[model samples]
Target: MTRTSLRGVIAAIVTPATPGLDPDAPRFLRHARQLLAEGADGLNVLGTTGEATSFSLDQRRGLMEAAAAGLPRDRLMVGTGAAATRDAVELTRHAGDCGFAGALVLPPFYYKGVGTEGILRYFDAIAEGSAASGIPLYLYNFPALSGVPYTEDLVSALVARFGGRIAGLKDSSGDIGYARRIAALPGGLDVFPSSEAVLDQARAGGPFAGCISATVNVSARHAAAALHGGDDAALQRATAIRALFDGKPLVPWLKQAVAARMGDPGYGPVLPPFVPPDPAAVATLVTELEKIDKAPARP
Candidate 1:
């Protein structure tokens, strides 16, 4: 099988929503263009940063379609994972049909205590169902949200079983040790760290293909430079920017920054169960982020 490379910065883009709580397709298209122009090599839409779980099936499909219409297929990877096997398969198939480069598959996450066999079976079923079209699959190993970690053994088995169909793994574990272990695997699977803090190490040949950071939605150019430069100063600046969202709700804080940059007041409102930050919190965060933004990028 020919080896597939996933080297470069891939932004986990936020799906912009209008004041009416509908996804703002035009805004998303503009964001995609901006990210590409700012030096992002690829876009990962519908991931956690995109509030994927909150979206209805129709909404998710619409987002994917809009992205496909706006960006080149090779530059887009849509998150298609769902708690249900059929839903994941259907979404993955849809991504392929819409011409996305690949589908980022989260393990079946709803059922806690699910055995490794169960998780493997879920992916196997989706892969088998998607076999005819040969849609590329990237494993999204975010144990924090999914509560199901993708162990090395499991990844190895899946890669061996899926062969060229399994494209890579996106490790959001936030544990550099685990990321290093995944990178050390023999097949040269594309390993993406979820945080920009590891870019220096990753750039120094640590097996990290690139980053798919939530913060990159707003700071794509800075994140891209950090990945390419691989210097401590660059990583520190990126980390400091991410630090702004540390104590607050990540999504809301991110939305606030994005809104401030784009001058869209509607961007601050999150969907149900994720209320916007209190006014005081938003004020403080805005001030802090403004300072960070104005600071020079490290040499």
Candidate 2:
């Protein structure tokens, strides 16, 4: 089987919420369409940016279904990773049933001390069960959150074992060295650096197929332009804009930034266990993001 190539800028889109925190279908569709219109090559729905862990299983299904309905299947990648293997398998099947191009599966993270052999087994199980589902599976390596890093050796073994079934990886560890190391692996596996800064190197012939960026929620146009044009100036601008939200707690800061852009006053509520950013922080983020928005595009 031929390797699946996922190139270009894919946006890790945010999930829109109504006053009571229910999934705002209309707003979610609007966001997806806006990202696609703004030059995003594909949509990564229900990702970290979309607060997938905060949502229940049914809610996740709803979001993926809505995204699949609103966007072209060829341009949509849905996160089907869950703490539970059964849930991951079920959700992945659902994503395929809904016509998503692929499912990004996080390793079984709830169990710590999961060795490389253990991780491989977990992925193998998913691949075996998902044979008929037909959704390509991409490993999600966000060690900071998952507590299970996809080491180079482990990644190689999985690729060799699963071949084309293990489509690619979204390396959100925020380490360029890790990203480059994974990209350097043989077999032409697709490696996606989770930031815009690496786009230049990726474009310069690294093994990276593209980027899956959370910042693209606000800077999709610039990110997409940088990826395709290979413009250093454009990439620098994207890096700077992303730097604004670098330190802020992601969920609240991202929602605040999105709300500020939309002029929505009530977009500050994050689901429980994760509070919204304080008003002062929101004000500061707004200021910072506004500066980025108004900054001149590099010539």
Candidate 3:
């Protein structure tokens, strides 16, 4: 059956933690609200950028419930994948119960060399477990970090088997060609390339639904203008700002930027196994961002 999927600029926001390093619900809600106020069509909380895996399942769920309570649930999707099948199922069900628009699920990454069939079975459980709630699942393909790429064939197979339950995908593979091909797949899947660089193409009638991007946290205003209004200058500025993060530690650098923008160091704490970004690097990013922000919009 055909179904409408989430489209437009969705920001994968950074999670703010308290000094004790727990997911700060009030701070998280504030950031989520801020993103929507700044022109983000939706928010993808607890994704890789939001440090989902770094937080405990309870922490993730508490934050999810808090977000759903405070924000428009239809405008929020949360990362629900885990290396463990049961945990993935639990989180996916919780997300559905919380009334989220969708769950962005990564492949079971702890296992290497698990072929498509193995991964398929893993998702089969997730699909069945959350079937009662009917929450859609957006396959997250971030091979570099997850090391478990969702091949096109696998995606097609899942869609065939699960239909609307397999709503769409977030292709962080950074391969626009692959994302385009996935968007071309049957069953009305909403394929979101993980960068605002493609906003112009999408507005040009490209197949992509829109973008699910970490950098959109800072670039949402420009992205929304570009995607919804066909503003090329806005698109360029958004992409230029996004490019500034290249080669830096993505999560920390983004947190640093958010902390600076909000003037609250509480946004500065990243979960362990990750540390704060270098001050010099953050300064350089801020400087370049200022230049892009000040550049005149093309007439």
Candidate 4:
């Protein structure tokens, strides 16, 4: 096994908020620590699930600082990319300063149809601008939301140039084939598919380092089972929990699940342009999840 600190079931933790929508720093870290207790090997804070772009830089830094202060720094991966390159650099520097193990970086996403070289330069700028050494960086490949995809060529170039610092990738592109392709890249690139649903296959034919998943926020135990061993029953129940959000937005629904589990509704509130899951949808989600929870765990 590779001796990487970032490997294993990592939760893409959601930011908790006050009813007035303020970033609740204390509650946020509490929920993050709760995920670790639930079997998450690490925490990826300020991710898409966290609405990172919606929060200000201060809020973002606050989360990283809290995670550093509360948890083991080597178990933290911060999402540092921003619409502006400077913001990404600033955030990445903070991760380095905090001794975080890695950074999950989105491309400069405001403009669409960027050339391959342009996207490559964008990452190059982030790397150079970060001005910190030994801070592992993982490209956050999420074309659905960012209109940006990390091409194999670009990734290859990054690895060749930056090697250890350009540590891995998170393919939230939701395409297992694409993720597998990247995983198969030469030079031992660490690859994590967006979901734990693919863990069995990845484990069997593995280039997978592990998963960084919103689903792990609640399903950590089951997700961990899938990665540590091909526990088909655990994976089945984990996928069932994820499938409950078939038509709902994932971030809000994940927050709702966390709130329901923690008995703290504060986790359910999202930022502008996104709202909490409605009552009816929440009911269906909870019902299905509860059924899975009580089921026996065996392959």
- Give lDDT per model, in order: 0.81, 0.81, 0.89, 0.82
Backbone clash pairs for candidate 2 read: none
Candidate 1 has what TM-score? 0.94
RMSD, candidate 2, Å: 1.8
Q: In model 2, what is the error at residue 290, expressed in angstroms?
A: 2.2
- Maximum-TM-score candidate: 3
TM-score of each: 0.94, 0.94, 0.97, 0.94
Q: Once superposed on the true structure, which residue ranges of model 2 sit more than 4 Å away at CA?
A: 1-5
- Model 1 regions more than 4 Å off: 1-5, 230-232, 297-299
Among all windows of ten consecutive residues in candidate 1, which has the lowest summed lDDT?
Answer: 1-10
**Candidate 3 lDDT by residue in tens digits, 1-299:** 54544778999999999889899988888878888998999999899999999999999999998999999988988999999999999999999999998999999999888987898899889989999889989999999999988898999988888888888899999898898899888886888999999887777677888899999878888999999998989999999999999888899988888887777878888899998877887888888887887798888
Candidate 4 residue pairs in clash (backbone atoms < 3 Å):
none
1-299 per-residue lDDT for model 2 (tens digits): 45553568888888877777777778778777888898898888888888888889998888788877877888888898888888888888888889888889898889988888888777766776677867888889999999988889988999888877777889998887887787778766678888888777667566678899988888887787787887667777788888988777887788788878767755556776777778887788788877776777665
The digit string of per-residue lDDT tens for model 1 on 66-136 reads 88887888888889999989999889988988988888999988888877678778988898777776888
